[model samples]
Target chain A: MMNRKILLHSRPQGLPTEDTFKFEEAPIQEPEEGQVLVKSIYLSVDPYMRGRMNDSKSYVPPYPLGEVITGGVVGEVIESRSDQFSKGDKVLGMLGWQLYNVADADKLQQVDENIAPLSAYLSVIGMTGLTAYFGLMDIGRPKAGETVVVSGAAGAVGSIVGQIAKIQGAHVVGIAGSDEKTDWLTKELGFDAAINYKTTPNMKEALEKACPNGVDIYFDNVGGDISDAVMTQLNDYARIPLCGAISSYNQEEGSDVGPRILTKLIKTRSMIKGFVLGDYADRLPEGAKMLGQWLAEGKLRYEETILEGFDRVPEAFLELFQGTNIGKMLVKVESTE
Target chain B: MMNRKILLHSRPQGLPTEDTFKFEEAPIQEPEEGQVLVKSIYLSVDPYMRGRMNDSKSYVPPYPLGEVITGGVVGEVIESRSDQFSKGDKVLGMLGWQLYNVADADKLQQVDENIAPLSAYLSVIGMTGLTAYFGLMDIGRPKAGETVVVSGAAGAVGSIVGQIAKIQGAHVVGIAGSDEKTDWLTKELGFDAAINYKTTPNMKEALEKACPNGVDIYFDNVGGDISDAVMTQLNDYARIPLCGAISSYNQEEGSDVGPRILTKLIKTRSMIKGFVLGDYADRLPEGAKMLGQWLAEGKLRYEETILEGFDRVPEAFLELFQGTNIGKMLVKVESTE
Candidate 1:
C-alpha cells in the first residue's frame, strides 16, 4: 500500500502561503519490533502550530524544513509487533499530517470508540479542553459573582473556558470576531454577553458596557487590541491567564507593539501570568477527570467543525486564522474508511 | 504654638511646579481627650506621594485641593491626653507636611531611638524597607545563582531591594540614571553589575552586557523605556514584582505607553505582580524584625538625603524626579528641635 504525507517546504516570514507546504507519496513501512503501523482517521489543526512554523525560540522546537508536519492524530492500529496493542485497536497519539505512520507502540494510547467519537479525542477531552481547564481553574481562579472575560470566545479553548466560568457561577462575557459567533456564544454557550469586535467601532466602550462591574478574571486566547481593551476594565487584584496570542503570531517578531500595561497594573495591584498546556503536565489526570465529570453531568458542551479528506488538512489550518470555525477545527481523513 | 503647612493648591498637568503648593499659617490644633499632639521632626518626601497629588482614585485618597499634604512623619509626642503616650516619647505616624499634628493615641507607634537613629524609622527599618522586603521575598522569590535586575537602584526601595537580593545569593544587576549612583550600587551595595542608563546610548545592549545570564527576577521601581528593555531579557518562569513606576508618574494619564508585554510574557511563560506594602500590613512586624536583624549584622546599610529646613519640603519632593538623592529623601523640620 502507498502512504501520503505533507511536509514543510519553506518557512514564511508572515502569514503562510500555499507554497509553504509540499505533498509526497511513499510505500507504507512495516512495523518493526515494539512498533505499530497505524491508519490515520482524524487530524487536529491548532493555532499554536503557527508558532512552530517560525524559526524562533518557543515552548517546542521549530519545525525543520522538509519533514512530515506533526500534530495530534487519531488512528486505528492495523499491525502491531508489541505487547501494548493489537490489530483493530483504536488509538490516539501525537502523530503527523499523513495517511499512515509507523510509531512506537508504547507512545500510543488506546481509546475506546464506545465512550465517544474518535474526533473528540483530539478536542474537548484532549489538549485543547485541558488548556482551558488548567488556565482558568489554576491561574484565572474565577470566584463566584466575579466578572470573567474571554477573548476569541468562539474558538476551541475559549468556548470551553466560558462554559467552565459559567459552571463556577461567574458572570461570563465573551469577545469574538463575528456576529454569528457572538450569537452562538450568548445563545448556545450561555455566555451573559458577547461582543462582535469586527462590527463594534469602539471595543473599550463595548467592553466597559458589557462588564459594568469591571473584569475580575480575563482568559486571553487572542492578545493585541482586544486584550488592551480588556485590560482597561480590570478590577483590583484581577488575574489574567494568558493562553495564546493568535493576533500577533503571523506578524514580524518586533512589530507587536502597543500601549504598555505596567502603570495600570501598579495602580490596580493586579497580576498577569502567561502559560502553556505543558506547564501543567503533572496534573493532566486530575484535569481529565474533572472534564469527564463535567461532560457526564451535562455541565459542559462542545462543538466540532470538521472538513473531509486528508488533502484539505492545510486548508483547515489556514481557516483558523480566518476565524471561520465555531469551535475545534479538525480534518477527517476519508482514505482510512 | 503656630503651624506652617503646605497645601495642594493646584494639580499640575505634568511636572509639579511652585504654583502647585501653597504655604499657609494657622494655630496649632489642640489634642482631644483621646489624642496626642505630635511635633513633627523628620518628614518623608517619597515618590509614592506624587500619586496622591493627582485627582484620581488610588490606594489612598487624592490630596484634595487646598489642604495639608499628608505623608510619613517621625515626631516627638509633646502633649498627651490619653494614657498610651508620654511627654518624651519618640513616635512614628502618618501626619501632614506641617510642623505639628494632633492624632489619636492608637494611631501612633512609639519608636525607640536606641535601636537606630530617628530617621531610620522613615527609611531602612520602616515603610520603605518593608516595601522591598515583601516585594522581593514574596513576589520575586529569587533563587541562589539566579540573576536579579533592579531599576532605580540608588533610590530608597531599589537600594534595599538590591541588597536583599544579594543576601539571597542571586547575581544582582542594577540600573541607575547617573554614574555616581551606579558606582554606589556596585561598589558599596554588593551588586554584581551596574548600568548607567542615562549615559548608555543603547540601554538594551548595556543590560545584555551587564546581565550575562538572563534575568530571573525583576524588581521594577521605574517603568517606561528601561522596563521595556528589561522585559526582553527575562528567562523562563521569571517573576517581576512591580513596586513603583516613578518614570511615568508625571506624564499625562494615557501618555504612559510603550511596547506591549503580553506576547513576551507568553513566550517566556513568566508572571508580573503589582503590589503595595499595605497589602502585607499584618506581616509588618515580621519584615521589620528581619530588616533590623540584617542592619545589626551589617548585611544591610542605608543612606538619607536630608534637606535642612521644612521650607524646602517641596524642593526635596521635586528632587526625586531629578534623581538628586542617593537614598531616602527627607525634609528636616528644624523648628521642632
Candidate 2:
C-alpha cells in the first residue's frame, strides 16, 4: 500500500512555506515484533512544531532535514504484531506528518471510540486538553471568583483553559485576534469577557475594564504586548501560567526584544511559570481522567479547525503562528473508513 | 523633648537626592492609651524603600509628601501607656524615619538582647533575613547538589540566601558588583564561586563555568541584564525567587521597561515568583527559629554595612542603589547604651 509522508526539506527561518515540506510516497512497512503498523487519520499541527524545525537548544531536539516532520496523531491499527492491539483498534501516538507509520505498541495509547470521537482524541481529550487543564489548575491555580485572563483564547489549549477556569468558578477573560473568535469565546465557550486584541485600541484599558477586580490568574498563550498588558493589571499574588508564546514565534531575524514585564512582576508580586506537558508525565493519567469526566459531562467544549488533505499539513502548521485558526488546528491525512 | 523626623518632601524621579527629604523637629507627645513612645536606635535602609517613594502603584502605597518616611526600626521604649511593654524595653516596629515615635504598643515585637545583638533584629534575625530564608526555601526550593545562584550576592538578602543554600547542601554561586564582594562571598561566606559582574566580560559564560550544571534556584535581588543572563542558563523547572530589583531602581526617568525574559522562561520551563514577607507572616516564627539556630551554630553568617548617624540615612539608602554596601545596609540613629 502507498504510504504518503511529508518530509522537512530545509529548516524554516521564520514562517514555514510549502517549499519547506516535501510529500513523498512509499510502500507501508510491516510491523515488527511488539509494534503496530497504523494508518494516520488526524495529524495535530501545533505551534511547538516550529521549535522542532530549528537546530538550537530547546527542551527537545529539533527535526533534522530530509526526515519526516514529527507530531502527535490519532490512527487506526492496520496491522499488529503484538497482542496489545487488533487490526481495527484505534490508537493515539506520535506518527508524524505521515499517512501511515510503524509505531511501537508500548508508545501507542488505545482509544475508546465509544466515549468520544477519534478527532477529540487529537484535541480536547488529548495532550492539548491536558496541557490546558494541568497548566491552569496546577500553575495558574485559579480560585473561585478570581479573574483569569487568557491570551490566544480561540486556540486549542487556551479555549480549554478558559472553560476549565469557568468551571472552577473563575471570571474568565479571553484575548483573541479576531472579532469572530472573540464572539465564539464569550458566546459559545462561556468566557465572561473576550477582547479582540487586533481591534482593541488600548489592551491595557480594555483588560482593566474587563477585570475590574484585577486579574488573579493569567493563562498566557500569546506572549507579546497582550500578555504584557494583562500582566500590568494582575493583583498581588497573581499566578501566570506560561503555556505558549505563539505571538513571538514567527518574528523576523533581528526583531527587537519584545516588551518585558519582569519588573512588573516584582511590583505586582505575581508568579510567572513556564511548564511543559512532558514534565508532568507522571500526572497525565490523573489529568486525563479529570478531563475525560469534564468532557463526558458536557461541561468542557472544544472546536477543531481542520485543514483538508495530508499535503496541507505545512500550511496548517503555519496558520498557527499567524493566528489563523479558531481552535485546535488539525489536518486530516486519511479517511478512517 | 524635641522629636526629629525625616519627611518625604518630594517624590523622586530616579535616584533620590537630598531635595527629596526634609528634616523636621516637633515636640515629643505623650503616649496615649494602648500606645508606647519609641526612641529610634537603628533604622533599616532597604531596597523596597525605593518603591515606597514613587507615587505610582506598587505592593505597598507610596510615602506621601509631608509625611514621615516609613521604615522598620529597632527602638528603646522610653514610655508606655499599654500593658504590652514596660519602660526600658527594647522593641522592633515600623517606626518610620523619626527620632521618636508614638506607636501602638501591640505592633512592636519585644527584642531579646541575649540573641546576638539588637541590630540583629533588623538583619539576620529580622525581616531581611526572614525574606531571604522563606524566599529561598519556599519559592526557590533548591535541591541538594544543585547549583544555586544569587544576584546582589553580597547584599543583605542575597548574602543570607547564599549561606542558606549552602547549608541546604547546594553548590552556591554568587554574583556581585565588586571584586572585594566576590572575594568576601567565596572566602568568608563559604560560596563555591563568586563572579564580580563588573569584571566578568560574559556573564552567561561565567555562570556556565561556575554552575557546570545549570542553575536550579536563582534568588534574584537585581533585575536587569544580570537576571536575563542567569535566566538563559537556567535548567528545566528552575525556580527564581523574586526578592528585589535594585538594578532598575536608579534608572533614568522614562526608561521604565527592563529586559524581556518571558521567552527564556518559556524555553527553560522555569518559574519566577514574587513574595512579600507579609504573605508568610504565619511562618516567620518557624523561619526565625531555624535561622536563629543556624546563627548560633555558625552555619549562617551576616555582615552589616552600617552608615553611622541618622542624618546619613538618605546617603546610606542611595548607596544601596549604587551597589556600594557589602551586606545589610543600616543607619545608627541612636546609641543603645
The collision pairs in model 2 are none
Off by over 4 Å in 1: A335-337, B335-337
Q: Which docking category, incorrect, acceptable, medium or high, applies to candidate 1?
A: medium
List residue ranges in candidate 2 displaced over 4 A. A252-256, A335-337, B251-254, B335-337
Tens digit per residue, CA lDDT, model 2, A140-246: 88889999999889999999999999999999999999999999999999999999989999998999899999999999887877877887788988999898887
lDDT of 2 at B321: 86
Give the chain A TM-score for each candidate: 0.98, 0.96
CA shift of B10, model 2, Å: 0.8
The best candidate in terms of lDDT: 1
Local distance difference test scores for all models: 0.92, 0.88
Clashing pairs in 1: none
